[model samples]
Target: MNIKFSGVLVGMVAVFAATSASASPRPDAGHYEWRAGTQAPGPRAPLAVARRVWVPAAIAMTDADVCQSMMTAKSGAMACCASHSS
Candidate 1:
């Protein structure tokens, strides 16, 4: 009787999952309005790490190429310059 009860429970769970999957919410349709006068938001810049992380802050220098190299060294391959800025 335990085996039979387990089989019924499994069947019920399967049916419930299938029904829930079918009843999933649909994506939003085009019903919103955009105001003409409002200005669009400016592009966001990527997160900046402190210069000290890339190089010693007390070096008393400001060099773009050196900074880029230091950034790449600290962050490895994940480090990249902004394409728009270049």
Candidate 2:
């Protein structure tokens, strides 16, 4: 392509890109913001470090220990007082 035509082609592409960018919604408008102290609304929260400790113990758990450990894990959000039951 000729130099002038190449430059025009480049300019046309740049203009198209700028127009496309401006036509889209602001990027932040589609995002969710979480506030401090308020936990996200869900049936369950993501697992934390202390909670992960129960998995090995949970695998070894007897029928009696299942409900007890589950409540301990959920309520504390971590296993501070959870004594593993065999």
Q: Considering every candidate listed, which one attains the maximal TM-score?
A: 2
Per-residue CA lDDT of model 2 for 7-60, tens digit only, reads 999999999999999997555444443334444556686433222111111233
Worst 10-residue lDDT window for candidate 1 reads 49-58
After superposing candidate 2 on the true structure, give the runs of residues whose Cα lies further than 4 Å from its correct spot: 32-86
TM-score per candidate: 0.31, 0.33
Candidate 1, residue 68: how far the Cα is off, in Å:
50
lDDT of 1 at 75: 37
Clashes of 1: 0
**lDDT of each residue in 1-86, candidate 1, tens digit only:** 99999999999999999999888664232233433333445567334322321222232344567556644434354234343132
- The TM-score between candidate 1 and the true structure equals 0.31
